[model samples]
Target: MDSITQLHATTPEKLTEAILDGVRKEINDLKKEFQPKEPDEFLTRKDTAELLKISLVCLHDWCNKGIIKPYKLGNRTYFSRKELVDNVFNSNL
Candidate 1:
């Protein structure tokens, strides 16, 4: 009666392909949902300072002293969020 009905009635192969395509898309979406999210790899100097509840100067000193691993991209400096958190937790004990 309708084009959709005509298509399904005339072409079972096409219908199967369409169904498989939809299933594939759904599977991919489910995979994405189930996948573990990556932790933040780098944090800006300001963000790191605020996160640690310290001043930028002290953060810089720590960075220089290797208390926190710092990465420099262009003129901007970044710190590893994981390392900072680890250092704080490890130091508390």
Candidate 2:
């Protein structure tokens, strides 16, 4: 006969600590993923704006019009550096 410890009763302090620890771990994992393990060209909207010397609004508009497509994930949009470079350098701009 074995007695089981019931973890269904969670103290507020313990719950908070557990939540914070989980969040911290998630943040650390996100940081690692964002650190770029290789030479990649994924750029955020801000990066695209700076690279193209264009406004965020303009970029969003262009993306919407399909002039320059954007990759969306959840709520974030990404642009490829190669595409921007090709557009800027290869074009008559």
lDDT of 2: 0.86
TM for candidate 2 is 0.53
**How accurate locally is residue 93 in candidate 1, as Cα lDDT from 0 to 100?**
27
Local distance difference test, per candidate? 0.83, 0.86
Candidate 1 — worst ten consecutive residues by lDDT sum?
1-10
lDDT of 1 at 72: 85
User: Candidate 2's residue-wise lDDT over 1-93, tens digit each?
Assistant: 999875778987898999999999999999988886656588999998998899999988888777787989999999888777777558774
Cα error, candidate 1, residue 48 (Å): 0.5
Q: Model 1, 1-93: lDDT tens per residue?
A: 655534435478888898999999999999999999777789998998898889999988887787788888999998888877778647952
Off by over 4 Å in 2: 1-39
lDDT accuracy of residue 64 in candidate 1 = 79
Clash count for candidate 1 is 0
Off by over 4 Å in 1: 1-37
